[model samples]
Target: MITVPQLDQYKDLIGEDQLSQIYDKVRALSGLHVMHFNTTERGGGVAEILQSLLPLLEDLGIKHTWKVVPLDDTSNHFTAHLVDMLQGNIPGQLEAEDQQAFLDTLAQTPILSRPQDSQADLYFVHDFQLAPLTTLFPWLRPAIWFCHIDTANPNQYAKEYILRFLNNYNVCAFNSQASVFKELPREHVQVITLGIDPFKNKNKYITREQGMQAIARCGVDPTRPLITQVSRFGRWKNPWQVVDIYRLVKQHIPNVQVALVGAMEAADDIEANDVLADLRKYAKGDPDIHLLHDPTMIRDQEVNAFQRYSSVILQRSSREGFGLTATEAMWKEQPVIGTSSTGLRSQIIHEQTGYIVDDTQTSADYTLKLLQDRDLWRKLGQQAHEHVRKNFLFPMIVLGYLDALTKAMAFAHAQPNLSGGQKR
Candidate 1:
């Protein structure tokens, strides 16, 4: 079992007054039980958020349970395609066979038995993978469909299919307003940005020397300025463009090295291997261009080291959900150069928090500036860290969830026919 530090432990970082306010909100949510459902228990942003959030919820005296729907080879392939369609990569209806496979897979999962055993007040169905759970289990009242993806321009068919399940939820939460579909009721929508645990292995405090040593173990020269982008190998993350940006940066700074870090084991992301293979081919044996995705080599400690020691971090995603990588870097007082994706826009304040660029040229330009100008880098890094501390930390996110749950419960109570908690 994974243990999360107690809420009180964050008192110093979040301030005593703010922590007290969080407890007040917890009082309002007294007796509430939240059930979270997703495709996998590890990898990806959703799992990371839940891993921290759920344990904290337990510590707060809230009843909660997490369940992962089992995915076989067939279902995994179908759902991966489904994710692409939802993200607007595939702009058509899911094939009939694929839809059937998705449904069949869900039907076999033991999650169906969970509704009977667990008396959850709210069902928090994450992303499109398990959105249909609201419909599959009619008793799941006051459910919140928390979507952590770039759904600003999802495929029409995918949008319609997802809406069918979303309509059943009490609230539809998104990382940004841009991700919310127009079809969803205005009242049903809630924009709750994702957050990072400051004390987690990936974001915890480490000395500069320790950071340097950790990166050196991974073959990264500690002396050279490192430009890193840590995210999963998703097409939307724009891993290829990161390589382009690196090459552009290397043009001016000969000693500069770029590390493209990503997780390759996300079950829903079947395209990771393909994208990584293509990235390797594109790099063409550039000695400075480090493509670090081996889980054994680049775990949380190494990521923490890279972010802490790097001159600048890049989150040049084409369409990011919330860019937790940027948030992580920001929390570590590392300046990030991100694209104008909605999520990045929400986290970055342009020149104030961090720089936001449109293309590889601008991204490269910003990277060069941050590397060359030490004072500018420190200014942005300090501002970025403060911004994350105020807005993107885990305690703030818990407050957001508590507020959303309070509103959802009220919404459910207002509906004459609807009722929350277990039916049995």
Candidate 2:
């Protein structure tokens, strides 16, 4: 079992004053128990965030529990479709049969029906997978629904279905202001962007020799200029656009290489295999174009190496809800070229931290520039690292959660009917 670092470990990165402020805020959350609900325990950003975060909460002397909602095949299929619709990746609403199947599946799951599971002081339901918990059990007071996807323009029917349960929660949190639906009251919503754990194996510091060795283990030459994108193989991630950008840059630097690294085993995303197949057909046996998706091959350390060794990192997402991969690359002190997606824009400060491009051509141009200009690369990389240290670190996220939970506790006390209501 990996041990979670104590809060004091971050003092050097965030300063003593910020650390003291966090301790002050955490004092108010003493004895609070927060339970987190999501679809999986080992894949995707939500899983990664909670994996790192829950431990830190424990270190802060706060009580917490993390749970993965049980999902049958039928439930997984329906929820997968629901995710697509909510993200606007597909068109159309859930049919009557779809909703019925989902409800029926939920009814069969023993965990959903158990009352003991609701013992936490506050419920932190994550993403669309468990959004219905608020509606199924209205007595689960002071719940906050954290949507970690791009939902600026969801399907009309899907949005309406989600709203049925969304209004029941004490608060709704999104990645950005643009992701906040206009239908939601301004006061009820909070914009809390996600962060990356710098101490993790995937983001921890490694020597140049170690990075080179890890890269060679994946069958890529560490000597050549390399461009890499670390994300899941999904439509929203736009892996194809990254390939196009690579090809454009390859025309100028013949020795240049591109690697598309993604996790193939996320439970909520059933479309990974299909997207990987399409990408294989598109790449058409270009030896320089490497697709590293096998879990056995690309684990956390390997991912860290790719991000650290790559000449330039790309996060060409069409729709993103706070790209953690971009932050990871930035933290590794490597310049990144990302699109104008809401998440990337929040992380990359245009020309200061990293370049934000509007089109594939512009992205490719930026990649070429970074590859050729060593001074610009180092300048942006240093600035990018500082940007993440100040804004998108795990401690910052803890502070955000502290504030949200404080507000929720205050609201629950004001409401007469809520159970376990108490003023802090």
Candidate 3:
């Protein structure tokens, strides 16, 4: 096990008051066990959050376990398409075969129990892959479905298909109030924003020299002002629009350079690759526009270094659940400019923490203003860091989950109509 000092390097943002409060809550629910089930256990935000969260929950004396549910390899094909379509990558209805394949995968994979006889006090399911649990196992322990995706009034086909999976959840939680899927059975919904772990490798402190070295290693000029956008290379992430905005800002600040650093999605969806290809065409060998595709750079350290070195962080996502990268950047005391849709709206405090813009031109204008005014940048960055530490860190998010779970358990016990499925 890593020592406390090492853990502190990542989690030092958790204050003593917050730690005491979590300790009391864990003791209050001493017997309650939390089991989190998701599809991929790596390469995504859900996995990264749970990796740190479950261990901390255990340390605080809460019985918690994280589990990765398995799906047929073939199903990933359809799932990849659905995930893209939902984000507006493609236009078409899911075929009958696509629909059936999803249902089949859900039915074929049984709910797994660890340690022979283990069940959970609360079962949390993430994203679409595990959604079928609602229909297939209505008698299972009262489960809460946690959605990390953008689901604002889902389309007719998606809403209908998702109903089978959602009705099973005792309560549903979304990242922002704006992303509430009002069409779903909304009676038991809650808006719990996603929080960051301040102690994580990406959010930890690095010297100014170290930050500069990391930027230099990426082949970017360490002396020039840098604007960065870190996200998975998906269309919804809007890397091309980032380029458009960077071009606009270049007229005002000729010395400013833009870097789009990102990890590719699982299996590299076809449309995302197409977008990257299209954007590269505009690059035209300009050193000012850098697209980094480094496989060795572990997520936290690289992101932390980039944000630390950046003059301003940019997140131009058009349709986001909550831009976790933006939140992470803000936590590092960096100013951010983002699109005005989805969860990005919640992260920015207008001109206070950062700026929210509706278009590329507006985002560029704000970027220019920040570059021109160093004192304003410092003030916004300081406030943005505190704002994230206060409202959006892991301890608070876990507390929200604890409170919701307690309420859900009470609600479940009162309703005899809802069934807890028999043992596997």
Worst 10 residues of 2 by lDDT: 415-424
Give the per-residue lDDT of model 3 (tens digit) for 1-424: 2223422443556666665655556566666788788887666688777887778766656687777666665777677667656555355678998788677776665555223443777777888767777466544557787777776645557656666566556777777776666765455776666788776678788998888888887888979988899987777788888888888888878988999987664442345566677778978777899887655753556677888779888988878888778888998888888877677888888899999887778888898889889899999999999899888887667776776676567657764112332332
Off by over 4 Å in 1: 1-5, 416-424
Q: Stretches of candidate 3 above 4 Å error?
A: 1-21, 70-74, 84-92, 110-118, 137-140, 183-187, 265-272, 416-424
lDDT of 2 by residue, 246-300 (tens): 9999899999999999867777777788899999999999999999998888999
Question: Using alpha carbons, what is the TM-score of model 1?
Answer: 0.93
Q: lDDT by residue for model 1 over 108-160, one digit each (tens)?
A: 67757765785688878898888887677777777888888888878888888
Q: lDDT of model 3 at residue 263? A: 60
Per-candidate local distance difference test: 0.81, 0.83, 0.73
- Give TM per candidate: 0.93, 0.93, 0.87
Ranking by lDDT: 2, 1, 3
Clashing pairs in 2: none
Against the true structure, candidate 3 has what lDDT? Answer: 0.73
Q: Candidate 2, which segments miss by more than 4 Å at Cα? A: 1-5, 416-424
